[model samples]
Target: MRLLLVEDDTRLAEFLAQGLAEAGFVVDTVAEAGDAEAALDTVPYDLLILDLGLPDGDGMDLLARLRARGEMLPILVLTARGALADRVSGLNRGADDYVLKPCATEELVARAKALLRRPGGALGAVLILGNLRFDTLAMECAMENRPLDLSRRELAVLETLLRRAGRVVPKRVLEEKVYGFDDSVASNSIEVHISRLRRKLEAEGATVRVHTLRGIGYMLSEEK
Candidate 1:
């Protein structure tokens, strides 16, 4: 899943970004509310981790503005403000969840996954198609109950294809979800990932197929 983290503390941002990356999320971080807004305008982020104390403006205003504009993506507020009213206010202002500073990286990852499990979020506990079962929480995939060994990029490509099974997912959309701003992507990167994924599934005798449309995109569906 793609996530946008709005934080100002340099050390903390780096720490959180590392942790989130380990959990299979494509994280793009911005230190100021203005930059955050700009990133939001261009990227279709799956989640937003906002800090209430932004350098340019209040994160609360950004939250409210997103809701006013009908941006329904999940938002998790991470801040140092820990009080009854502060928590309540964050929730009332459209934050899906709130986490105080000094939080454990493990706890933050768990909470983020919980939000993703909710309706309209990008994740589910497990995604299943035919004999292929993907445990999203464990970040593992199996076919016919046998474990499937896949690299990080291959796993991400498989997940995206599985999520949009039976539909043509544009190549551009796949690129956005699998890569962050900091990562250098090659022109044929997405094609390479998908090609590897297709081979793996076919080799495993999977009942599903990954089809490529020339100059269009890719699709996954059960073989008839």
Candidate 2:
């Protein structure tokens, strides 16, 4: 899933980004609250990892604004504050969860998974398109009763398509979903991945179709 991490500490941001990436998350790191806003406006992220202290402003204000605007994005507060009032305040201010700094990476990842497993999040564990099924938590793709061998990028592409099956997913949207804001996506990167995914699905006897509309984008549909 795609996550936006708002952190001001360069070292902490880099460390968390690397760990989260290795854990199969598409993460974008922003050091300031204003940049975080811009990132949110540009990319559709599944969750937010927010540090309360930002360079431009308090992350609390951003959290409140997002909540006021009726955003249901799951937020995990990551900060150095670890007091009863601080924790309570963070929760009361609309954070889904809170984690103090100097904690283990595994614990942070576990909390993230817990949030994603919530009712309105990317949970229920799986998404289905025709004979193809994807286990979101496990990051597994299968056709009928057979497992398909797919690269991480291929899996990411499949997930994006399956999430919006039968609707045209814009190329730009796919790029943001597949690669982070800091990563450079080539002009034909998505097309190349989609082509490889199509072949893999067909090879595994999946009846799902990935259709490309010239100049538009792509759609996943089941063959009748």
By TM-score, the best candidate is 1
Error of 2 at 37 (Å): 1.4
Q: Over the stretch 97-196, how does candidate 2's per-residue lDDT look in tens digits?
A: 9999987888888889899999888655889988988988778888886899988778888888888889999998888778997787889999999999
Which residue ranges in model 1 land beyond 4 Å of their true spot?
none
Q: What 10-residue stretch in candidate 2 is worst by lDDT?
A: 121-130
Prediction 1 global C-alpha lDDT: 0.92
Query: Model 1 residue 112 lDDT?
Result: 96
Each candidate structure's TM-score, on Cα atoms with residue i matched to residue i, is 0.96, 0.93
Candidate-wise lDDT, in order: 0.92, 0.89
In terms of lDDT, the best-performing candidate is 1
Cα displacement (Å) at residue 38, model 2: 1.7
lDDT of 1 by residue, 116-150 (tens): 99987888889999889999888899997899999
| Worst 10 contiguous positions by lDDT, candidate 1 | 149-158
